[model samples]
Target: MFPQSPSIASASNVDILIVDDEPTNLRVLSTIVRSYGYQVRQAISGIVALRAVQIQPPDLILLDIMMPEMDGYRVCEQLKFNSETKDIPIIFLSSLVSGMDKAKAFQLGGADYITKPFQVEEVLVRIDYQLTLRTLQIQLQQKNNRLREQNERLKQEIEIRQQTEVELRRSEAQLQGRTQQLQQALDELKLAQTQLAQSEKMSSLGQIAAGIAHEINNPIGFIYGNLDYASEYMEALINIINLYNKYYPQPHPEIAKRIQVSELDFVLKDFPKVLKSMLVGAERIRDIVLSMRYFSGYDQAYAQQEDIHIGLDSTLIILQSRIKEQTNRVAIEVKKEYGEIPPVNCYSGRLNQVFMNLLSNAIDAIEEKLEVVEEPFHPIIKICTQLSNSSKQFQDKNTQWVEIRIADNGIGIAPQIQRSIFDPFFTTKPVGKGTGLGLFISYSIIVEQHNGQLQCNSEVGKGTEILIRLPIEVPQSLDVSTTRKVKIAPSSLSLESDIGEM
Candidate 1:
């Protein structure tokens, strides 16, 4: 076993080149290196050594400084300068035992230097030391190269993660915006569906009411016309009975007995009253039919000149049942301040719907208030209409307008929610009681269709006042006088008596 070999397995197949001018020295070094289980090549000169290294590079080299043609210093310089051979360990074997020469050998990239007649033990020790050092350096370099590759991969991964995070944030923002858009669209769709349902229902109701009114008008007209003649005939018959009694005062007892049994006196006294009551009843029926026909307005196909007062009255007549006295509250009072406004050109049916929605809401508010308020709270709706020749709201100075204000003495809307009252599907009423499309449709009919304005003024505890301003469409031939204010005194419209018949 070699004394300086790290292991027999490590020394296997290790190639070394020995160069000198002396054949004996080359043989000796080669033999010694080969005995340590290393493959050796011999060169008698430095030139031969360079050629052998160029042909097939070795792991280690042992060179003599005193070679011919090319010295060990020159060979070492040539090997160290080459990129492929620079890492090979070089040892200097020389007879010159000077410190300067050793220094010179090391400066020329020599690994170790040995004197002439050196011990084999020293030669092997130096070779083993240099080989072990180079092996450790190679392993460290390999580890450094692996660490650098890992760091590069980690850097790339970090970059990819950062990009992914940025994309995720962008996607989240887009999703949020899209969600809001979808929600808005869904709300709009709901509002539209409810409004369509309400419109269809109202249209059907109008048709039914118009049909009923038409059917009743014929019979009521006939009964109303004949009632007067029947009353006159009854009067004549009573006169004949009286005259016959005067002429036949001395009649048979059987005739007088029959008269007494028939209660002729009571008939004579009550016959006229019964006819009068029938006449009154027939008249009331006629009035009700007329009111129903007017309120239905299903036959009105186009915009025409209409009296706003009549529209309001027709809507009130239709809603009279709701305004009637409840168990907890008295009948609601309506105060009208009608101005001398001319007939307005408008869609009477749609205008009536607007009035209906507003008054209905007013009644609902009053009823809601009645729930919490004590007695003595007389709920009232104040309606005021005014005509103006010129207004700042009108773009044309000469144009005229009709302004209406409907106010109530009930629990008012909060200020924060007032602005949204006209928005579709916005309501404070209980679920089944309100569809929330009343005000929204009313707003559309007034502002969008009629080119008018609808605004609300309210306080939380006091009440709400909704003002409507519409431009009056004056006809060519119709004469409208100067604006004059007409006020109707406040009156209680108690529908308690009328609701039963309705």
Candidate 2:
């Protein structure tokens, strides 16, 4: 059934083309179409109908199959194949009404077929129905074109995201390279500083050595002169004793009593004490040289082991200058509740960098929180670590992860912007105050480099809880989609090798 179309604005809106060998059929269709407010063009043969369409296309075509020179089937085929005239609905109007004929007409691309001696009502119904179908086909084609355009645009958008990921990886590689270079320079600087401090300390020892040499050399010189004088006195006394023994061998007891034997013994003992003091002064110089050597050989290489505890301590050390009070008097206090955690495989220096960034951000948030400081609010920070139960929580029948959570009591993020926090260059901080890459870099290290998970939970005006879950033993390769929520087993964490250890 066709819709009873409301009358168009003008009779010329729907044009009808009628083609037949009989002049009577043309007259009949023209009259019927004119009543429906349609303009009509008459053709004596199929050749004339095709020529007429090329000259002036019509909305509908009434075709005759039995004609001279060319038939309706040939005309319909030629018209349907042409891009310009293909949309014009063609209907076969003929006396040859066999089933095979109707099927052949349609197969040749005819919109409809009716007997030449047709009812006016039946002809009108078939014409309206064919025209309506043509309209629907046009709409469907238009819809398909629109969908194709949308898919192309979506494809372009995906390509842009993939390109962005590639650029991000390049940027991360550059940053890592620069960090390694800077670390090397810092190590060199520390070495120079250690050498400088040792030099300063040894310079003082040089002065002390000069002072000891000046003060003790005089005493040592006089002590040696006194020993020489005592040797002369001993030689003179032996000569006298020999002479007396020769003269009075029997009276020796009387002569020995007369001589001062006790006084002579005192001189011998005091001379040895002076020489002993000189030897002790020489030994003091050797002790000072040993102390200087020990100071010069301070640890210069990054040979320190992964000290989870020391990592945190170094973080505190780096953040010390930033934590002060009002008027740049901001001080951050830290609280810790450490638990039994296996040593993680990590570069302590790099981990220290991460910890320092986090600690500074926390302190900054607190300082800003007390902007209009009525009274000094103590900016408190808490650093805690514990053995994770991630393995117990998400048992995958294989491995487990270690969970390290960092919490801060500061103005939190809005829910709408929560998911975007990990996005590159996305930050809530004032412009120039943050690079927005800190968290992104940290996220990549944990999630990309270590095959870990980084998640945040926060509400506006409330604090944030940042949880980092790292696998105990990193697998040979990682699939983000597959191992996103996996746990690191306690047994696996036991493969703790201090990356920095010698």
Candidate of highest TM-score: 1
For each candidate in the order shown, give its overall lDDT on alpha carbons.
Answer: 0.78, 0.64
Residue-level lDDT tens digits of model 2 in 244-322: 7678766656556654555545654565565566546544433333322322222223323354666666456434557
lDDT of 2 at 137: 76
- Candidate 1 lDDT, 196-275, residue by residue in tens: 67776877888888899999999998999999899889989999999998888877899888889989899899989998
Against the true structure, what is each candidate's TM-score? Answer: 0.62, 0.46
* Count of clashing residue pairs in every prediction: 0, 13
Scored by Cα lDDT, where does model 2 land? Answer: 0.64
